[model samples]
Target chain A: MFAHPFLQNAFLAGTFVALAAGLVGWFLVLRAQVFTADVLSHVAFTGALAALAAGLDARIGLFAVTLLVALAMGALGRRARPGDVVIGGVFAWVLGLGVFFLTLYTTVRSGTGNGSAGVTVLFGSIFGLTASRAVGTAVVALVICALLLLLARPLLFASLDENVAAARGVPVRLLGFAFLLLVGGTAAESTQVVGALLILGLLAAPAGAAHRLTTRPLRGLALSAGIAVASVWIGLTASFLVPVLPPSFAILAVASLTYLGAAVGTRLRGTRPTVVER
Target chain B: MTGTFSWNLLADLREMWSLPFMLNAFRAGTIVAVPAALVGWFMVLRRQSFAGHTLAMVGFPGAAAAVWLGIGATVGYLAFGVLAALLFALLPAGRGGGDESSAVGTVQALALASGMLFVALYKGFLNGTSALLFGSFLGITSRQVVLLGVVAAVALTVLALVGRPLLFASVDGDVARAHGVPVRSLGGVFLVLLGVTAAEVGQITGALLVFALLVLPPATVQVLTTRPARGLAASVLLAVVTVWVALFAAYYSPYPLGFWLTTIAFGGFVLAYAGRAVVDRIGRLAVAP
Candidate 1:
């Protein structure tokens, strides 16, 4: 498994993505912004398309656009913050832009005539990414984790209670925006290996599963990251060994199953899952 | 480039009449717009947007499984979407705290993963798999246009019949329940309606862009006015116009209809948003201390 470069790249990229997804996802769930993360995933798709349309590396567009949009979204609702209705509105518009870019890439790009790039971006082509690109993804994932850690306490405070955190002089708005940026970064990097749609499943499943199992915040976050990493590791190994399962499906199944198992276990044991109710 | 540009814009517009598929596309876009906006309006009002998004995604697996089972993808899309909607209702995100989100997210993840797996496994004739997300343009036929029309008509009729009570329940379920509205039943029915719409829209736009027709127009309209009648009118109008123009653009260009529609819808939302912001500033200035 290690000898194959594609497999190696997939493993490295998957590891980085899983680690960041776990850490960021814990905060994402804590903030009750899973939908926000979903929005960023769409943003990533649009950015990737825009980049491809412009003939630049899609990763650049993916990361930059997602980071900017996530921040902008996080800043919304200060006064008359629009609800899911408004978010749904933005969701539609962004996807339109994504389609526009995808069309341009498919029609105007010089060499890629088959229009398969769009599919690859949506479904992910992680196994085909070069070793260096995979390594770069890993590094970016590390940076995202470090920044998230530095802001964790403040962010957690804000997520728990915006008004209270603001009264205590926390930079709630800025932290909220920063948290989205981290999510954007993680989604973009992970999409390199797992693809856009699959990234969502991988990103949410582990943190959700962890949240269902524990009461301690830090422990939950740790557990979330651990579950994410294990999902990726096991998913990759399964894909490698069986050669029948697609990595994305395998990874999603593993993480979602963890969540499912935990959900059932909590019900069976009748232990109340401890989470802060906002 | 000059030769292609020689036709005046209106001449290009008239050319669509000559193309049957383009006509069908126009018809489908126009017909579906109303129901999508209407149902989407209620979905937003109900704060079931998360569930709505998941429902859109659920169609992917439905379509894929349909292909695996040697059926039309549209059949699968509706089948999967409606089932998921009913399931979400059964699980009821209400009162579960953040657990509601967990359930919805898990459902979406599982649906999509299975869709992927089905696609990977099926050895039969499979086409338009990408259309499950980016949508199929120029693929719209008269048959599809009629199917969409039928679904839209049925869903719209149901929505109208139940509009008053549904609106009450959506805004304040507990109050509506206190007032004798069948809150639980309404939730179930609305999910089913949403599922049908999702499947209908799934045929025109891909799963990924479902919100374009369903959510954006209504969202913009809601912000533009406080009056329900006015908002509903604006939403339907915007939706119809967005798709009509989008279909026209798609017919003339290489881009798919969903993209053009989404972009146009997005542009409309932004314009309305900025306009609202400007009005607010002006009002504030007038009241300045």
Candidate 2:
């Protein structure tokens, strides 16, 4: 499988995507912002379609739109965490915009012959990546992972106790704004690997599994990233072996099953799962 | 497909209904809207939007598996929807917490992956994938409309029966439980109802966009009112109006019906939110000095 250029590209890009998603997802679950990730996934789709409709590169739209909405959501939410109401409102509107752009792209730009573009945005087209595009995706994912590492301590402080962090002058709100932007970037990137519909799986499942498996913050973070990368590798291999399986399906199925395993393990250990206090 | 809007609104509406497809679309949209808004109101109140979203997402796999099995999509929708709801009900209720959200996310992922698997396994040309995800108005058969009506009717009747106790439980679970309200069972029942509503609405707005009818209208009305009766009434009204206007607009325009439905519903929410903000500002100014 590694002999094939496409398989090589898939692994290269999928590895980095999984790393960034795992790190960012640990913080996302810690901060109770999984809903925000969900909202951004839809935003990535709408942004990509909007960009296509306006005759621009879909990546430009994907990144620009998700980032802007993340900032906007940060501004609208209290303590930089948007409530359900805000998330739900934005979610519906973004999906609506996606439909509008789909209509425009189908009717005016590419015609109905190219309906696959929309499907690609919804389900991802990772195997279709060129060598250059895969490298570009890796570079982007590395930058996200590096930035998240730099912000990890302060972000953790802020996420664990916003009031105490604010009292200690940790710039809680700024850190929150910055963290949301990172999440937005990761969400946009994950859309390429898993598609808009299932990006949350890559963002939440491994992190959640790690949380269930361990309470040590640093160990959990490492475990999360490890599980994520393993899922990607295993999923890719499974899909390569079974051509009938989609890559996204394989990846998310592995990720989710890992989480279930952790949950069941914790239950069998007969220990009450430690609940992180907000 | 290039239909122009005319000044005569009545004539245009009559012309719209003159087509059988448009008529069926209207019927289906209306049937989906009422139960969606009703269940969505309680869902928002209970802070279960994540669960509602998960149930809606499950419809994709339901539809895909149905197509794979050569069965009706509605059966798949309702079956998967209720099954997922039951699964959710089995989880320890941790409202708006990280544990609950993670669990919900995991379920959503599993369901979506299963959907992709079903789609991959199906050898036939599944051309209606777009319609199943984004929804289309062109294929609203009379049979589908009638099925939606029956589901809506059953859901609404259950909602009516459990309305009061459900509200009490949702508002204050501990107290309701102390008072012997069967809080847990009521929660389970409501979740099933929400699943059914999500499935019904999924047919009209698509599985991905079910929130257009389920969340937007209820969220908007809750922003506008605190009274339960008034909020429920306003939610139903907003949803029905949004669906009617969207259907009418979509008939004349080239865009899909789901787009118009979501856009109009979102517009109502924005208006409500802004209106509330403006009222609070004015009230503060009146009190100051």
Candidate 3:
């Protein structure tokens, strides 16, 4: 699995992205923001295309746009009623922009006589990423993981207990905004590896499966990242053998199956019923 | 600049309607908007927006499988959507709300991934995945238009019969259950209705933009009104007006119909929110310092 150059890049890229996604996903789940995490994936779709429409690197728009939108969602969600309503509003808002950007990218490409080589906004083009780009992606993912570790203590405090953490002078709102930005970053990176639409599976599944097994924050976090990285390894290996279907979908499948397996396993034990996080 | 501001709106409208496809597009849009808005209103009211969204996501796989199987894409959409809906309904009932969403989220994520897999497996897929995002709305033929009419008629009529009980159940499931409304069964029925509506709207707006059509208008309307009947009517009205205006704009402009529809719908929501905030401020001022 590691001998081929393209395969190496795929493995490395998937590893880094999954690690970051898993770490942030634990917080996303604990915070009851899986929908928000999903929303950021959609935003990343527009961000990448919006970049190409302006003749810039797709990665630049991918990160910049998602980070900004994440901040905006965090701020707006605080003021909006019925949290689901806010999420729905954001979904519509981002999708409209994605449609606009998609049209713009297609039209601009056709007009400029450029080959249709831009980012594939529908599912992503992870299989086509060059080795150098994959390395850069891994480096960014590492930086994101490091940043997450720095904030892990307070972030968990806030995620587990917002009002109590706020009363403890934890700057809960700031942490929320900051956490969303991290989610946005993870989303942008994950989009490159599995496309935007599938990022939700990568981010949510591993953490969910880990949560199913254990409730302790650190153990669950480690287990989540482990599951995520393992999913990538197995998915990449499976795609290598097949080489037909894209690896992103395979990665998502592995992650989802892990969660399902864990869900079933936990149910069988009858010790831990799935707790609804409020 | 091709579609610069025109003073003679009527002339532009006349020119647009001259084309048969444009007429078909508008006709289809008109049909799909009603039930979408009606169900959308209840979706938001019941706080099932997440489930609604998950259903929309499932439509992608539904449509993709339809194309892969050489059956019509419409069949795939309805089949996959309804299948997913049944699956969601079957998730262990009444586990804490949190567990249900997680399960729903897991199903949604898996469905989306499976959609990609199905598209990839089709080997002949050059554009099927993208179609799942934007849909092929501009090329509506007369047959599809007629199909749209049948679907819209059935969805609206069913909604009419179930609308009252559905709303009561949505507002207070426990109370409705006490009143012999079969709340659990009604929940299943509503999810199925939502599935059909998603498949219907997926034809107009594509799976990606389905959330816009199904979630935005009703959410915006709810932000403005609390009265049940009035709110329902307003949501449907908003859906109709936005679709009509968006159809007109898309025909004259160089954009896909779904884009114009989403933007116009979002614009309505934002404007309503601002109006509500302003009115609330005035009411507060009148009541106190």
Candidate 4:
């Protein structure tokens, strides 16, 4: 599998996407913003569909829409983290827009021979990545990971206790807005590897497993990234071995199973999962 | 796609409804809307939107499995939806906590992955997959409509029987439990009901657009009112109207029914939210003297 050029591109792109997703997802879970991530994933799908309907590059739609909506959500919610009500309202609207675009694309573009474009956007087309696209994805993923690391400490402080961090002049709201942008970027990038529908698995499962296993912030972060990368590598290999299995399914299966294992292991060890100090 | 709208509204509606499929679509849409709105009101009140989303996603795999086994997609939708709901109830009630949301995400991922696997394994053309996710109003057989009516009736009756106690438990679980209400069992029952409602709506709005009918109408109503009876009634009204208008619009235009349904529901939510904000500001100004 490694000998194939497409497989090589898949590994290169998958590794970076997993790293960024894991890092950003740590903050997402810590802040209890998994729902925000969910909203962004759907937004990615809608944006891509809208772009396709308008006859533009899907990548342009994927990134631009997710970024805009992420900032808009920050502005809508208090402290840049939207409440469930706001998220639900926005979520429904985005999916509605997605349906509109799907209809438009199907009606006008059906005979153009790219009938599966919508499906590819929904489920991801990681193996179809050209070398250049893979490289582009890697560079974007690295930037997201670097920006996240640079802001990790302050972000953690803000996430753990928003009011205290605000009082201490940590620019809590600004950090929150910035963090949402990173999440948007990560969601868009992960859409390439796992598709819009299952990006949450890459984002949440590894970080959640790491949370269950450890309390130290830095260790958990590293553990999350490691587990995510491992899931990608294992999932890719499994898909390669069993051609009937999709890469997204394999990756998510591994990732979620890891979380389940951690939950069961912590229970068996007789240690309750540690709640972050508020 | 069809003739331009004329000044005569009733004539236009009659022309649109002259088709057999449109009539069947209307019947199924009305059947799905009421219970979906009712159950969704409680889901929003209880802050289980994530869980609701997960149950909807579960329907995709269910449909895929049904297709794989050469069975009706409805059976797969209802069975998978209820099974996932039961599984959720078995977990400790973490109620909007980080753990519960994470678990919900995990389940959504696994279900979607399985859906992909089933799609790959199936040998058929799978052309209807788009319709499964985005919904279609073109082929609503009478048998399907009758099946939907029966499910909706059963679900609505169960909801009515448990409605009062369930509201109490949702409002204050601890106090309700102390008062001898079966809070835990009620939660389980509510989840099952929600699952059934989601399955029914999933057929009309597709697996993804279920949120349009389920969440948007109820959320909009709650934003405008706190009275339980009024809110519930208004939610149903909003949902039914949205579905009817969407179906009518979809028939005349080239856009899909799911799009029209969601867009209209979302419009109602936005209107309600803005209206509430304006009223609050005016009240505050009035009191400032």
DockQ values for all predictions?
Answer: 0.60, 0.74, 0.55, 0.79
TM-score of each: 0.93, 0.98, 0.94, 0.98
In candidate 3, position B267 carries an lDDT of 84
Candidate 4's C-alpha runs over 4 A off are B1-4, B124-126
Query: Candidate 3, clashing residue pairs?
Result: none
Better of 1 and 4 by TM-score: 4
Judged by DockQ relative to the true structure, which candidate is superior, 1 or 3?
A: 1
Query: Could you give candidate 2's per-residue lDDT for residues A1-278 as a string of tens digits?
Result: 79999988999999999999999989888888888898898899999999999989999999999999999999999978888888988898899889889889988886447767887888887788889989999999999999999999988999889999999999999999999999999989888877888889988999999888887789989999999999999999999999999999999999999999988888888784676787
**Compared with the true structure, what per-residue lDDT tens digits does model 3 show for residues B1-289?**
1344476988776776777877787788878888899999989988888889889889888888888788888888888888988988887776534346656777887888788788788976755566676776667888988887897788788888888898888888889988999878778888988998998889878888888889988999999989988988899899989888887777667887777888888888889889999999999999996
Q: Which ten residues in a row have the lowest lDDT in candidate 4 chain A?
A: A269-278
- Error (Å) of candidate 1 at residue A32 is 0.9
Query: How good is the docking of model 3, as DockQ?
Result: 0.55
User: Per-residue lDDT for A178-247 in model 1, tens only?
Assistant: 7777888988887777777777777778888888888678998899999999998998888878776878
Candidate 2 vs candidate 3: the DockQ winner is 2
- Chain B TM, per prediction: 0.93, 0.97, 0.94, 0.97
State in Å the error of residue B55, model 3: 1.1
Model 1 iRMS (Å) reads 1.7
lDDT for B25 (candidate 2): 87
- Tens-digit lDDT track of model 1 for B63-171: 8889788888777987898898888778634564456676677678778778878888885323466777767856787777777788789889999999999988988
- Look at candidate 4 and give me any clashing residue pairs: none
Put down candidate 2 lDDT per residue, B1-289, tens digits, no spaces: 3367898988877887888888898889888889999999999999888889889989999998999899999999999999999999998774456777888888998798888789879864445677778877778899999999998999999999999999999999999999999998899999999899999989778888998888999999999888999999999998999999998788777888878888899888899899999999999999997
